[model samples]
Target: MSFPIELTAALTGASVNQLRRWSRAGLVTPEIRPSRPMLYSFRDLVALRSVCYLRSEVSLQKVKTAFSNLSEHDLTEHPAAYRFATDGTTVVVWNEDRFMDLVKNPGQFELVTINDVYRSFTNSSDRVVSDFEHPRENLSVAPDRIGGWPTIRGTRVPFDTIADLVADGDVTADEVPDFYPTVSPSAVADAVSFQEEVEGLAG
Candidate 1:
């Protein structure tokens, strides 16, 4: 399933504007672009995660260069699938067999290892996963399930979907349980209250 831009932004720590800019630049494009609303697949999210991490370590120009170099190599794997590292001077990618400094001759570098990049990527991915999985009380986000939205615990229903229904006044909190029998009335109320609290903070 594809995810909306808001969830993608939350998962990648990228602003909506940044995502738009990246899309325009051909740096990261969503899988589904059906006119008004854009949707990104999980692969796009993984690619964006790599882009953001690399950009943080080096300049965007260098990151772009690395991507170009990788494309030229005709690597079988996607750029995101490869491990990357930058020493503030050059970018290197692990081509499975060995590390190659894309800035220079795509050869081995003794100073850095794929382990370093792997560790950093793991930490960053963990934080992002944690943030998405537990953004608020009574809500859970499982990237492997439910399209990675803030869903009600123990159910696939998105909290925002239910909250929007109640906020529109078309469905009262008490009636929410009738529509979604899987969720309890208290859970529905919690969803409404959580949305209100979030809106209050945004205001």
Candidate 2:
């Protein structure tokens, strides 16, 4: 399912620049040739969509990491199901009982109420979608040759503090996890692929 640049950008809500940036980030691999604009594949869109889902809906770095871990896992089991439908807004992939409790008592989930969290979550999801539409910058780095790695820039930050800033807006020096670090997109992909291979060994 190859898509033209325009269509892919529309569906993912990523801009041409952002798409290129992601490609540079090694998050998505698109086919670009000299004198040719760019081409995207369905798989690429799925990867970007997954990234967007992680940043928004869950709002928990660890949960996002778990989701990525699940993607790398060899388990063929389908993702856990919830009672409500997700229009790709706030994804709820918990077990049945936990989901039920969330829906019955929304405030427990940082939601005003379980009965109506669906709508609110979905609405807020639009921002991430839009980020894809109008990306801030184009690819800062060029794609690499075979066996090349992603180019990561920023420095590392503690996972706990990162999570706190992303979630509760509270950050204490002690809350920061000593081991949290940043990696290039290519590195992340490689690590994920390695994890997938390891999980495959159990089979």
Which structure among the candidates has the greatest lDDT?
1
Tens digits of per-residue lDDT, candidate 1, 6-69, equal: 7677556578888888887877778677334879876677677667767888888888888778
How many clashes in each candidate?
0, 5
Which candidate number maximizes TM-score? 1
Instruction: Show where candidate 2 strays beyond 4 Å.
Output: 31-36, 58-68, 75-203
Query: How would you encode candidate 2's per-residue C-alpha lDDT over 103-128 as one tens digit per residue?
Result: 22322332233533322122322211
lDDT per model vs. reference: 0.68, 0.37
TM-score of decoy 2: 0.31
RMSD of each: 11.7, 19.5
Per-prediction TM-score, please? 0.54, 0.31
Which pairs clash in model 1? none
What is residue 46's positional error in candidate 1, in angstroms?
A: 1.0
* Model 2 error, position 102 (Å): 20
lDDT for model 1 = 0.68
Which residue pairs in candidate 2 have backbone atoms (N, alpha carbon, C) closer than 3 angstroms, thus clashing?
13-132, 13-133, 14-132, 14-133, 106-114
